[model samples]
Every structure is written in structure tokens, then in C-alpha cells.
Target: MTAIEQGTAGGTLNATTARLDRLGDAVIVIAYIISVALYLRIMAQYMVGFFIPGGSPIWEPVIACASVALIIAIGIFRGFTGLDRLDRISLAAVLVLTTVLGAVLLIHDGTLVTSSTLRLPPPPPVGTLDALLILGGLVITVQGFETVRFLGDEYDAVTRVRASRVAQLVATSIYIGFVLVATPVMGLGTAAGPDSTLLNITARIAPWLALPLVISAVLSQFSAAIADTAAARGNLTGLSSWFSGPRPYLISGAAAIAIAATIPTLVLVTIASRAFAAYYAVEAVIAFRTTSGVLRKCGFALLAVLLLAITLFAQPAS
Candidate 1:
């Protein structure tokens, strides 16, 4: 009687776990679709800004056309290696320019201990949903490292794990360094919009920097968009054997165009943040279930709760 009771409880628990895993898988697929759409929208907007000096009359239509072209191009590409190389080159160029600008700013003032120029700004008030959302939106900035998990065909599990760790470390270092270098100029841009803010900031330091900034933006965004598209394709294929060849990419592209037509680019960004937060929350839950140590389980549970809050409450930037 005792053995039968134990077996019945174990079977029930296993059934519950399986159902949860299936739900998590569905959520992840939806998140990946959102990610692909957001990436394409961003890349299209940046490309339009780079090529067209003044804004076009039909802005969203122009973005849609550009996104369609980009989708086609990504479909034609055979692999990520070339795209990765180009992305690295563009990133290196931008880093060099940022470093140079920072060095120039420091040297311009003769007094190293200047009072007004070098002071860090006071921390902004954060006791509100708006502030929390703003900070949560930053999760997008640290996003690309997880792409390794979608590249199973190209890399083994061990290699993907190792690569993801290295990618996260490198990306975090770069983000921190870039922020530090640009701290002085952060407050300089007044009239610049989202797409041109970095360009305007760079122009203030050195007018010649604008050309490289635009080129870097174009290259890096395009590469990143392609990466996201590929990841979405892989995810869809994993989710369903029926999703193969160009079918998944086509569906993603259509969804992206529909989203671009309906949603503002800024709102699209917030939506992406919410999607990624939900995805990560599900992953955290899975991690909590799979891990053995109490500390690890507690940590994952805490992370899942925080991510779920971001998903539910994070708002679009004003």
C-alpha cells in the first residue's frame, strides 16, 4: 500500500512537470517571435535614418519596405560567420572612436581636477514603476549573449555554454567601458531623437566622427538583425518539425511588418523588453526545478519573480 501511494504521487508530479515544460516552451516561442520582429524594426529604422537625411512622408511604410528587403537578404545568407565578422569590425571601430572622444574630452581642459566638467550626475529617483521599467528596459542591452543557445547545429552543447559565458563577459565589459567613455557627453544632446542621439553626441566631439558612426550603426544593426532572424528560425524549427526552409522566416517577416505598421518603434522596444523578461522568467523557473542546491534554487526563484515583475509592469520610454 505504501509503495503504491509513493508511485501515484511521483506519477502525478511528473505529469505536472511535463505540462509546465510544454507551457514554458510555448512562451519561449512567442518571445522569440517578438524578438525577431523588434530586431527587424530597429534595423529598418536605423537604416532609414542613415540613408535619408530628412524623414520621409510615409515613415512606417518606408520602414516596412526596408525590413522586407533585409529579411530577404538574411534568408539568402548561408551562415552567421560572415555576419559575425562584420559585426565585430563595426563594433571595434565604434569603440575606438568612443575611446578617442573620451580621451580628447579629458585633455581639453588643462586642469585635471575641474569642478564642473567631470562630476557624475546625482542618482535619479527610483521609487516608482516608471523608474523600475526604465532600469528593466536595460535588459535588452545585455541580450545578445544568449543567442548561442539557438546555435546547436553549429556548436555542441559544451561549446555553446562556454561561448555564451565568454560572450557575456566580453559584452558586459564593452558596455561598461562605452558607458564610462560617454558619460561626459551624456548630457550634451538636447534636440537629438532616438536614432540620431549617438550621432549628434559624436558630432559634438568631432564632426568627422559622424560618417563612421552611421556606417557602424548600419553594419552592426544589420548583422544583429540577421542573427535574431536566424535564432527565431532555429527556435521555430525546434518547436515544430513542420517549420523548415523559408516558412518560419517568412512568417516572422510578415509578423514583423504587421507589428511595424501598428506599433511605434519606441513602444516596440518596450514590448520586446516585456517579452524577453517573460522568457527569462520561464527559464529561471526551469532552472530552479532542475538544480539541486538550495541556494541556487532560491536565487533562480528570486530572479524569476523579478523578471516577471518587469514583464508585467515595464513601460515604454517617454
Candidate 2:
């Protein structure tokens, strides 16, 4: 019998199964919390040093000011524009940045860095454990592409799917151009360790445009943060009646992030990222709870197992 059918009946086995399901959900929740804590750390170290008392990062204050102004604009405009409208505008900003980046590549003549310097040694054979460990992480580094699922509540599934598809296509085109451009320009080691890769690229190729790129990237990050916050709040609200509103998640999640900020970035991104991947795998299984038909259920069950393997075997992209 299906999960829904079991729920409809008053039977002995069903009650036990429900208890087990709750237990599994509880485990997943714990894993997700741990993963987020690590992710927050990564943001602090590699992404942006959120709290800067004072130093050489003069742009931090500029970005902060611009972010504040943008938030005010969002508040005034959101009711009229709605989330979908705002997302489209933000998406356009990202595309514009990509276009500018591409233009810089065209204008800059000659290779900036040698091909040999950028290349890494080949991995072990595919079936080998080492090869799997090395290769799997490359996939997990791009885990955020599925975040469109979170926006399902605000828009129709068809709309969300279309948006995600368009985003992927555009982003892929931009990324391909960027990789081709940046490969020859940036030395392999320097790009990997960048505090701000966008800023680094602009500085190297187009110094005059650095300020605009900085401001644009900051705004893009702001929009992404807004979307992720909404997703987290939505999930929390669905989790329990006690957390049935926005206020709880807003207050609690904010404080939790504040605490998470204290942790080291390396620890968070490397260790916690794997934990998130594992949770992503389990989430697939949970998604099948409402699915019908034995064959479809079996397929999803196998998919979950496959995801679980990837999650466990995958290494950190860094």
C-alpha cells in the first residue's frame, strides 16, 4: 500500500511506520541544521567577511550602504512588483554583469596566464575509490541549481520549471564564456583563493569598471540571500505548528546565522557541505512519500540510493 493509503487506515503496522517516518524526518532536520552552520562559515571566510571592524577592504562599507539602499527599494517595490518580478530584474543584472565580463575578454589581447599553469593532473580510473572521491565533489560544488524548488509556493510548477530552465541556459552560456576567458587571464592558484573573484576579474581586465562590478555582485548576493531566506522560512513553517509563521524563523534563523558566523569557513564549507549533500539525498526519499504506483516508487527509491552514494562519496570542491 502507498503512504497515503496507510494514513487513511487505522491499523497496527501503519502507526509504527508513521513513528519511523517521523524519526527519519527528525534525523534529516538535524543534518540540515549542521549543514547550514557549515555553509554560514564558508560564506564568512571565502565569500565575504560579513563583519569588518576596519581595514583595507574599503569596499565593504560601500557594498553595505548599497545593500541597505537596495533593501529599502525592495520594500517599496515588492508589494507592487512581487517576488517573481524582483527575481527577473535580479536575473537581468546577473546577465548584464556576464555580458560586461565577456566584453572585457574580447578587448584584452594576448593570453594572461599559460595553459600549463592552469591544468591539473589527471584523476585515477573511474571505478577506483580515489577517482570517485575526487570527481564527485566537482558535482556537489554546483548543488544550488535546484533552489528553484523552494520558490514553488510563490509560483506555479510550470513557471518555476521554465524560469529554472532559462536561468540554466543563460548561466551556462555566460559561464562557458567566463571559463574560456578567465582560464588564460588568472593564474590557477590566485583565482582559487580570491576573496572576491568578480572584483579580481574586473581589476585585472578593466580597472575602470571595478566599482560597478563590485556593486552589481553585492546586489546579486543580496537578492540570492533574500530568496534563500524565504525558502528556509517556508520549510520551517511547514515543519511544525509551533513554527507555523514567518516571525519564528526570522528571529531564530537570524540568531542562528549570527552564531554560525563565528565558526571557521574551511570547517563549514568542506565538512558541512557533505552533510548538506547527504540531506539532499534523503530529501529525495521523503519526496516519494506522496508518489503513487509501485514502479514509480521503485524508481524514486533507487534514485534516492544513488544520491546517497554520491553524497557520501563526494569531496569538497575547494
TM-score: which candidate is best? 1
Error of 2 at 130 (Å): 6.6
Write down the lDDT of every candidate, Cα atoms only.
0.65, 0.51
Candidate 1, 224-265: lDDT as tens digits: 666666777677777789987777777767766676667766
Q: Where is model 1 more than 4 Å wrong at Cα?
A: 1-22, 47-57, 76-116, 119-128, 189-196
TM-score of each prediction: 0.79, 0.61
Q: How many angstroms is residue 60 displaced in model 2 relative to the true structure, after the best TM-score fit? A: 8.0
Look at candidate 1 and tell me the lDDT of residue 242: 90
Minimal lDDT window, size 10, model 1: 1-10
Q: What is candidate 2's CA lDDT for residue 177?
A: 73
In model 1, how large is the Cα lDDT of residue 311? Answer: 90
> Per-residue lDDT of 1-318 in model 2, one digit per residue for the tens?
234234635453345445545544444444344444443333332234323322223343333333433433443345323544675677678668757766776555243333233433233345567666645544423444555654545676677678778878876776677766765444433534532354565665677766666545544555554454445444455557676534533443444354354444343444444555565566556556556788878887887786667666665434
